[model samples]
Target chain A: MLKRVHFPASLLPYLLVAPQVFITLVFFIWPASQAVYQSLLVQDAFGLSTEFVWFENFEYLWGNQQYRDTFGRTIFFSVAVAFLSMSFALILAGFADRVIRGSTVYRTLLIWPYAVAPVLAGALWLFMFNPTLGIIPFILDAFGRDWNHYLNGGEAMFLVIIAAAWKQVAYNFLFYLAAMQSIPRSIIEAAAIDGAGPVRRFVTVIFPLISPTTFFLLVVNAVYAFFETFGIIHAVTQGGPANATTTLVYKVYNDGFIGLDLGGSAAQSVILMILVIAMTVVQFRFIEKRVQY
Target chain B: MVEKRPGFTIVAHIVLIFGVALVALPVWITFVGASHDGARMLQAPIPMWPGDQFFENLRQTFFGRGLDGSRTAPVWMMMFNSLVMAMMIAVGKIAISLLSAFAIVYFKFPFRMGFFWLIFITLMLPVEVRILPTFEVVADLGMLNSYWGLTVPLIASATATFMFRQVFLTIPDEMLESARIDGAGPMRFFWDILLPLSRTNIAALFVILFIYGWNQYLWPLLITTDPDMMTIVVSIKQMLEASEQTPQWNIIMMTALLAMVPPIFVVIAMQKLFVKGLTETDK
Candidate 1:
């Protein structure tokens, strides 16, 4: 059957892929290579001196206290955001699964945040958190606790985390909701017939069925938190008050483009690539075993 | 004799209603804040009602900025730039992904699996990892501050291609064979039969891509240095980031509202297809 298929053996893959590959190679791959190459050379005010400095840039960033601190903060930010958002998504998805009616309403509302463009999401968060005029501050003041994100690094970090989680939890919920609904109704019915209550049924049957989805979302959410949070981060804090909000990606941007330290930025980018690769590999190696087809 | 659990339903409704309110709060606040006068927006009690400043605020934002420091450019011009860039990316991604997916799924070719894995692995390398590299590339190509620079790199969407391939795989081989026997060329068969059969998936993909395309911020922000070339997201951010000056929340809110309209409509219009796309049922 396979041999009988008329395959355009010579022309097909090349024809199909030429345009995408061309664009990617020129636009994606070329630039990525240049970034790495740029990292290996030292450039001066007169222009790039182009002398290869093999591991100097990476060494400098690794040993630099500021970059190291930002790297630590970036890890903490990504992990904290992923854990908080995914946990909330899990609880909300679980709760919504039980509702026979009004579930659509819950789903739509939950999904609403996902629909808000990232730019708008940042703006909304900023408006709500603005100190003198922000709603969050007003509410906090009403409760008698003074709130400020501008001058306080911890407060700034907390607010950024909340904003990031707010934008993402809805997305995670949608995926979880779909995965939960995919569970066989008969399996749940059979479990119920065996005197399993909601919690018991969830723990034994539903959890197992949704394990794959959870694992997939874990990797997906972690990647997003690591990379995509830059928009809101850039918009809201600009890596803020005392550099508390400066993430690895933000630093890459700063060092390469803003700081004009192209070599330093490229080095940071390489490290980020390594971190993502490592995290993804770990996720697959460890979590893949827990997931069911 | 029935034991009534009326309270459970009431409690559920209450919870759902409150949850919905919380979710909608930011969107609601944005719209309301956009309409209020700028000074009024920053007052003690945040304005909860829509004001009369929408048009004035919008007009000021769009026409207020100039590119060469000589004359001001229309806000619509910036919107146009963003729209064009987004469309290029969307169209390019869809067309390429469709073709690659068809070839991968239907045709047996050497290194086919390898190509599939190569593209799919990119799904792991989140866009940020490639930024420094991508920037250097654009700069080398002299595409910095240009529209093509904004679109091309991003058009390389492995995820979309993967989705299309998966959808195409579900089509029965018998149909394709029959088409071949009837002398419908491969391209003809793909366009006429396969495409029609996959309408649901196509619609779903369009919505997904449109939302993704519209929400793109960082890549565009990095590539385009000229304000005239800026997307609404970058422009709004520039307003917020003005050093030593109080950022105008009202105008920023207004710009954000305008930016959000496209994706929101795309979602509402294709709402059914989106849900279907998310929950793919096995035939």
Candidate 2:
């Protein structure tokens, strides 16, 4: 990865790298290792004594129905968020890519939502869905359907998913638009000459060309739903309505900080670490494959 | 244009307008909520149009204590804390990443790859996963409720370093060779040549990082327990929690608007640089 003509070996390199290396060691590496170590030890009630029991926490998690339910919920949440945001962004990008006029205006309007904090996003959506005074519920009231996320588990999950997906649409839209723009215009022209309609041309020509971007956005959106949506969940649901909205990351916070189950929390952290590493590997592999193309 | 399809063109405009409306809906609601008086905001089917109370709500949210019975700082104080945290993170990350990338690319040294991998590992383990232990570490160091605890742990970024490395690699070798022939030391060469050449990338990265730092929620929520130390982003959650008692939707929405304005302004103002930074760094 280095340059061909590089400077000779010197002590200055160590001096230069010291700040980043030091921060990583202290903040990232040390804490991560501590999580691994703590996962093997369980503290008794009242913080009295600790026993080293390797893999017991993991086994306990595997056997726990609530934890298994959270695992399933997290998968469902991530997939739904990815699918919703990606498809919404794909449609918007498709339209924006079609007409060359006012695209920048549309893009500027669309991309500002990316700057919003996830917590604020939650706040905005939570306000909109406020059962008493919410506009959405007010609209639904006219249709004779009740809307209240406070007591309804499905509605709570749906609210958090919408909030999360809303924040991510800007990012996915940008990538999809870029990908579509990079496709040669000649292909679409040839398709038009073959008497294919816009829908047929898009389904055959444009969709296949941007499949890589779609795949990449899929991974990115999953990771976003996994980790970055923590603020949205915290502000909106707090894993509420009987843990219907609690994902794995939310579970880690709840168990560790609120529930005061240190060993269990550490075990959850380690599991999350493994998930993140796996996702990163997949992302890098896909990126490298795209580079070769 | 590929072909003059009038019907498709009309359909495209309609879809784009609908998309923009959906995207803008939340912000518009927030804005309308912010503009009204408190009583009006609390009413069902809250007014969709902006109210004349905009300046009054802005004054109350910015200067007055946030939410009745809440023990938080004024909105301005939290905004100040957010600014400090964001500036420190953006500048600190760029500084350290530039140095490390320079050292790795230009100088051959012991454990170079070792250090590289160590930094790369930080990317895999996000702060969310290791929240407890990381919080414990910060608590042990007595850095809680401080800006150092808020920003430093989050600044150890591998993506920025890798981006800088890519930028450096693309620079022609002759620039460094000539600098060496001029008897310039490493730091001097870095200051004179590398930094200047990568200025655009640095500015672009700064915009992205600024938004990233400003929008951080969970880390600041955990660390900054002091009222004065709370960031604007974190305070929004506290205000939302407080709303259960008093339900001051107007002031809360005003605060939300203020929280989002800075970064949104940055993105809209520097659209080109932001797009470049985002696409290049992530890919």
Candidate 3:
């Protein structure tokens, strides 16, 4: 091992990072610990009265039927959204890589939605799905199909997934496109010269090379699906139509910020943190090795 | 790169066009929707033409009064908030990431690998996981409802630092050796050498971090209850939830579209930098 010695230059780097370090400790670590502490005691909405209850909040949260249902619903929503979005993004990215002459136009346009803030993205879709004024139902009605996101739970979930997926496709596309572009053209041409068809070449050569991107995106998208979709869900569904659209993070936001159940919200957050950490560990241990670059 | 087959090429064009259409559809909707007045908006198959009412809609979104009869805050106010917040986050994040990257890659340190993983772990947490704890931290420090609550917590993260470190590591050590032989101090060497060469990564990180900060919703929503302090994103959320009886679809669409302009402009304007930045990493 190289014996580590501090470089005088190192102080500059540490100084640069100092604000972040302070902020993270103050905002991230301290709040996380505070949440655990707050969880042991119940507090009123005014945030004034406090009563200590050992694991009482956790027990109440776990035992409640609504919490369990919301928990299951959240998992279902996360898994479904992640898989569906990534699958569509992957297929579209693969197809986009092959056909277009001026592909940069497509690339640039495709990534535009990602630039839209999630709040605006959600509003765009919600406006389309709006029962009274939205053009989506009108467009569907023209095709001999009637649609209402507000009335139908399944339709609402589908719209939520589509909304999430639409914003995300560009992100996945960027990674896939970058990876595909990196594959040596000569190597792909050599495979093509062997008379392998497009599908066959993609499956045998291109897919394996881009598998790293696929895996990385998988982890990235899954984490996104898990934690970040709260805004979309909140803006569009509000866990509506009998709590069908509720996800874990949304539920955390609801319970903590809205319901004023600080203890329960904190418990949910702790559990969520644990779940994320576990998934991350699994990715590093099992999946990261498969990434090519 | 594949051999051109005319028949296959036709099919590929169709697919590419279809993908572009799907991606572009929402943006087109936003543009048109922002133009139409509320009555026209409710009409089926929404008026395909851009309306002159775009100005009227814009007039209302910023200057029109709310149901409580308060004058609507200027669109520039929202833009300014976003601009200030995004700039703060970008400056803080870039400074932090670059310095951290420099320290890890260029300097000798004890427990370097351990620190690397500690930062790396943050990449997985995302803001969503740590938000609750993060919120509490702000509240505990009496920073809630302040700009620091919005700006400070966002500064720390592992992604950009990790990325920059990876890029910096690829720089040949001989350059640093030469600089050192010239009696340049470590600080001077970094400022004189590493900063210039790392421009591409810096540009890329700028776009990514700017977008990240600009797109933030839940944190700002949670921390700042004051409408004055509320970001454009949270403002849009509030507008979307406002009652149906008095709903102003035109202004809502306009505000939403208004929020989108800066980030899109940033991305388009910086497209070259974005591509160059990422491609350099693969080398």
Q: Go through the candidates in order and give each one's DockQ.
A: 0.47, 0.89, 0.53
Query: Which sequence of candidate numbers ranks them by DockQ, best first?
Result: 2, 3, 1
Give lDDT tens digits, candidate 3, residues A162-186.
7887788877787788788778888
List the global CA lDDT of all models.
Answer: 0.74, 0.94, 0.75
Predicted candidate 1 versus true structure: per-residue lDDT over A111-221, tens digit per residue: 756666655677788888888888889999999988788889998898888888888877788888878876767788888878776768778888778977777777767
What lDDT score is found at residue A39 in candidate 3? 76
Estimate the TM-score for candidate 1: 0.90
True contacts kept of each: 0.51, 0.89, 0.59
**Cα lDDT of model 1 by residue, B147-255, tens digit:** 8888877887777786777677667778878888898977898899878987778777667666777678888888877767877756767767651266567767777
Stretches off by above 4 angstroms in model 3 are A1-17, A41-56, A142-146, A186-194, A285-288, A291-293, B62-72, B106-118, B275-283
Predicted structure with the largest lDDT when compared to the true one:
2
- Taking the tens digit of each residue's C-alpha lDDT, what string does model 2 give over B47-124? 999999999999999999888977788999999999999999999999999999999999888899999999999999
Error of 1 at A146 (Å): 2.6
